[model samples]
Target: MSKDQTRRRILEAAGPVFAEKGYDAATVREICSRAGVNLAAVNYYFGSKEQLYVETLQYGRDPEGQHDQPLTWPADAAPEDKLRLFIEGLVRQMLGERAPWHRQLMLREILQPTGACRQLVERHFRARMDQLLGILDEILPPEVPLSRRQQIAFSIVGQALYYRVASEIVKFLVDEDQRQAHFGVDQLAAHILDFSLAALGLHPGLAVPRPEVTHEPLEP
Candidate 1:
């Protein structure tokens, strides 16, 4: 393989290992084996396991580094629209069918932060957080403190993440029929958007229609 190909292979192989085992327990030997490269390749290419771990995380989050930059919206777009798009994008990124290890690695880092956590936050998460906070600033009143706005931002993200982190619990709480009907990506996104907008006084709360019930006469 070419030099770039070798590096890419190692990264691809490393993400799932680190995500499943975490930094401390994951071995460079195993990563190299999975990549189908000699063990020396890791040391030669990455210099050390620590550096490899950091780069592995970066690769998982965004191999091209495109996500480090803020996303653009049309100049005339309404703040509510911007917020809806942001929420929908976040929900899809978490819940969409993609590499499972990507979200798993990120979630592991968040729950059990390591030395490399700072780099992940700086490179991948900072811009996204700023974007969400900017949206919240527009919808929330000026009287709302920055701290409160930050909390709101966390709340919005937490709602989306709950479906992933607590996926099993969600399945248990919501039956298959209900999940199939109301738990689709677009459905969840719209519900979250409407619920948030209503809470912020941007729109009226959603009114879910009650299901019809049939009754039999006691005599019959």
Candidate 2:
């Protein structure tokens, strides 16, 4: 395999192993064996198992880069409109049908953070939070305390997470067809938008809905 292909193979293999066994129990040998590469390949591509784990977190964040950046809104878009788009995108990123390891590895890190957590936070999570915080600024009054703004930001984010993190429980509670139609990206996005608006004391009934914008590819 080419170097890039070899590196990708390693990451793809590592994601599931680390997610399943976690950082401490997962071994370099198992990852290499799964990737179909030599033992040295891990060191060659990622330096160490710990570094490999961190890069795998990046891959899980968006190997496809579907959710790498915050949603783009037109300059003249309403704050409510902007917030809706952001929530939809966030929900889709979290719950959209994609690789299992994408969420599995992330949840592992969250529940049992390792050396990789800090880098993942610095590289991915913080930037996404800043984007949400920017959206909150437009709708929120200036007098809102910074601490309160952060709480609000996390509240919005937490809603998106609930669908993914607790997805099994959700599936158990709803019929399969009900789960399919209601939990779809577009529907969930609208629900979160209306729910969040109501929580913020904005009238969801008064907000105008616009066509959801198609996502542009992540920046290279």
Candidate 3:
């Protein structure tokens, strides 16, 4: 295989092993073995186990991440629509190509964050949050504390992630496979917009209150 092809094989192989075994437990030898590449090939491509882990995730995230720099939405679009596009784009990135092990890998990373995870949070996620908060400023009063603006942003974000990250437990709680599957990111995105409107001290009759910020930011 060509060098790029070889690298692709290694990253593809590494994702599941890292997820099944975790970052510390999973070794380069094991990932190489699974990829049918010699040990040296990994060092040749990624230079280290940590970088290889990043390559594995970048495979899925790069498309979005590459284009995911802060956006200035159209002058015509409403703040609500701007918020919706940002969220929909985010959900697509998280659920990229149904790369499921990413969710497990993410849970592992979040529970016990590595240096790389910290960088990702600082670079990718925090950047998004800052941008989202700026847009949210129009609807939310300026006097609202940064904590509460974040709280509002998190509510919108969490609604988008619940199905992908916590659906197994959520499915069991609901006890309906059909309903569980239907509880998709699209529906989550739609629901969150309504939730966001209510959170800015306005009452939307019959809107369910968000319980609390319990789960960490789901993959996106």
The number of the candidate with the highest lDDT is 1
- Model 3 alpha-carbon miss at residue 46, Å: 4.2
lDDT score, candidate 3: 0.72
Q: Which tens-of-lDDT digit does each residue in 28-110 have in candidate 1?
A: 98999999999999889999898898888778678786653345788578999999889888888768866468767776777
Q: Which residue runs of candidate 3 sit more than 4 Å off their true CA positions?
A: 1-5, 15-21, 25-30, 44-47, 54-72, 90-108, 177-182, 201-203, 207-220
Task: State the TM-score for model 1.
Answer: 0.81
Q: Is 1 or 3 the stronger prediction by lDDT?
A: 1
Query: Per-residue lDDT for 166 in model 3?
Result: 73
The residue pairs that clash in candidate 2, if any, are none
Best by TM-score: 1
Per-residue CA lDDT of model 3 for 100-173, tens digit only, reads: 67656765676567767566545656677887897788767678898988887887777666655675787677
Q: On residues 1-220, what C-alpha lDDT tens digit does candidate 2 reach at each position?
A: 6879999999999988987788899999999999999999999888988889878888877787677444688978988888988898788778766647756676566656675567765556677778888888899999999999999998898888898778889989999998887778888888888788988988644355535646658679
Give the total clashing residue pairs for model 1.
Answer: 0
Separate clash counts for every candidate: 0, 0, 0
Candidate 3: the clashing residue pairs are none
Model 1 stretches with alpha carbons more than 4 Å out: 61-70, 99-104, 206-220
